[model samples]
Target chain A: MEARTKAEVLRRLRSVAGHVEGIARMVEEDAYCIDIIRQIQAVQRALAKVNDLVLAQHLRACVTTAIRGEDPEERERVLEEIVEVFEAAQKI
Target chain B: MEARTKAEVLRRLRSVAGHVEGIARMVEEDAYCIDIIRQIQAVQRALAKVNDLVLAQHLRACVTTAIRGEDPEERERVLEEIVEVFEAAQKI
Candidate 1:
């Protein structure tokens, strides 16, 4: 990952971590069930955004390089890797 | 997504959902902090795996098609998208 991206991811992760900690406290205190679930949902969404960013980076750096490279075999390998990932995603 | 992968993903997601419910119960009962944290960690890891699988699918179905297609402009567009994703990731 680029330096800037790395910093941003870390920042977001830290924020998420803090949020999680607060949720834990809420749980301990017997906070409202709906409120806790709502917080969890927000965290999940934030994490999804992070995941999207990483995947995009992988495509640009790894997938793009394979496609642009001269070697046919490398291109094929990249293609297969992508297919594997798709298969995995489908499982999810 | 393939049928088999789709089934698997759904199964895992259901399992995770159940696990989350369990965690919520634990919170309600004032479970041990460490234990709750451990379960949360496991859930997070499971979630990460799901994200990876989705990303892989995107790369295979979307990125691969763009790379192999005849239109240079389409390829460029895909590349730009990948770059944008990377940029977005950095902001995470």
Candidate 2:
């Protein structure tokens, strides 16, 4: 991971963690149910963003290199991995 | 993605989605608060597992290939991406 990307992801995750804790507190305090669910959804979306950035970095660096390389095995492996990620994304 | 990995990830995600929905219902019924939080934590852990598998596939294919390739740029890029992932994992 690039240092910048690492820093960004960590920062976002930390914020998400705090958000989760806040939601938990809200629940404990008997806050509105729909509001709590909305917060959870927000955290999930934030996580999805982090996943997207990480996957993009993988594509730009690792996948591109494998596609450009001479070895058939490496190329096949990288392609399969990329397909897997896409499939997972569809599930999301 | 390899066919097997794709199938497994999809199946797991489907289950997790169901689990999440179940949690929502529990909340609606005003089920025990601690129990609901536990379920949420379980879903989060399940997601982390999916992320791990995707990351492992990246490492085995893209990162390994880049590290072995002749292009210094590719090598450096992959190494940095990996470091970033590790840093993010630590935040988790």
Candidate 3:
């Protein structure tokens, strides 16, 4: 719920987008192996922060609701989604 | 932000917590291999939904902020975090 925090996240994402594009360029230009790897690593770090922010929000909001709500279907769907993400995350 | 959506997320999380605890129990009891694996897989799925929800929020809020704000530190921190998460996810 930090409006400012949300804005900050977005700004960082845009910068990351540029770096990603740079990675594509490096590949096209046949950049050095380490350089490419370094860029990839940079992308990874950027994603981690985004991950933290999301997790924080979920704990604050989603987790709060699921406890009080009586609808099982909604709860199930959310549970299913979490599993999906965790699985996908494992792959990445 | 959908207030209702937040609530739903919480409910799902509680159920997942139960499942995770169950997995711990299975480990202690030396439950069937398949059963333990299945429970771990289930946990993975639950994490995924939370991931998506947070990502949506980031795109909506953080990305928007970085675009408008002049602060570079906030942006950098966010980017760094993303990369960290991405790497951790890879390990998982």
Candidate 4:
């Protein structure tokens, strides 16, 4: 992964971690239920953004390397992994 | 939210907080990008469950109270809130 992307991803993930802890605090304080649910949704949205970043980075770096390399097995493996990722992502 | 639901929600959110922090550690360690994305997806699934619990509690208690109360305005407000939630949720 590029240094810039990794740093950005880490920053986002750390913020997400804090947001989640904040949600827990809200629940502990007995805040309005709808408000809590909205916070949860916000976290989900943030995670989705992180997921996209990681997947894009993977495709650009790791997957590209494997695909352009001289190993047929590695190429096949990377192709299959991409398909698997999309399958799992459909649920999200 | 009810006491039991609140406790469960808090427990889950705390665990989610731990999981998000763990993902940040994975990134810091330069773990595989696909693996990090999968971890992000797992956290999202956890958040969705929390959202469901909070929404169910709201519907059963808060929304029910509003609907059954003498204030028609409160009932309309709650109904609109639910609709808005669903519309937002459709993208997720």
- All candidates' lDDT scores? 0.73, 0.60, 0.67, 0.89
**How well is each residue in B1-92 modelled by candidate 3, as lDDT tens digits?**
56866777787788889989999999999999998998899888787666566655554356335523567676455545544554466566
lDDT tens digits, residues B5-39, model 2?
Answer: 54555565566656755654654565533344345
Candidate 2: residue B48 Cα off by (Å): 13
Q: Highest TM-score among the candidates is held by which one?
A: 4
Cα TM-score per model:
0.51, 0.50, 0.47, 0.96
Writing each residue's lDDT as its tens digit, candidate 4 over B2-62 gives 9999999999999999999999999999999988988888988888888889999999998
lDDT of 3: 0.67
What's candidate 1's DockQ score? 0.10
Q: Top model by DockQ, which number?
A: 4
Best by lDDT: 4
DockQ of candidate 4 is: 0.82
Q: What DockQ values do the models have? A: 0.10, 0.02, 0.11, 0.82
Cα error of candidate 3 at position A51, Å? 2.2
Better candidate number, 2 or 3, judged by TM-score: 2
True contacts kept of each: 0.13, 0.00, 0.21, 0.78
- What is candidate 1's lDDT per residue for A20-51, written digit by digit as tens? 99999999999999999999988977876676
- Model 4 residue B25 lDDT? 92
TM-score of chain B of 2: 0.87
Off by over 4 Å in 2: B1-92
The lDDT-based order of candidates, best leading, equals 4, 1, 3, 2
Sorted by TM-score (best first), the order is: 4, 1, 2, 3
DockQ sort, best first: 4, 3, 1, 2
Badly placed stretches (over 4 Å) of model 4 are none
Error of 2 at A88 (Å): 1.4
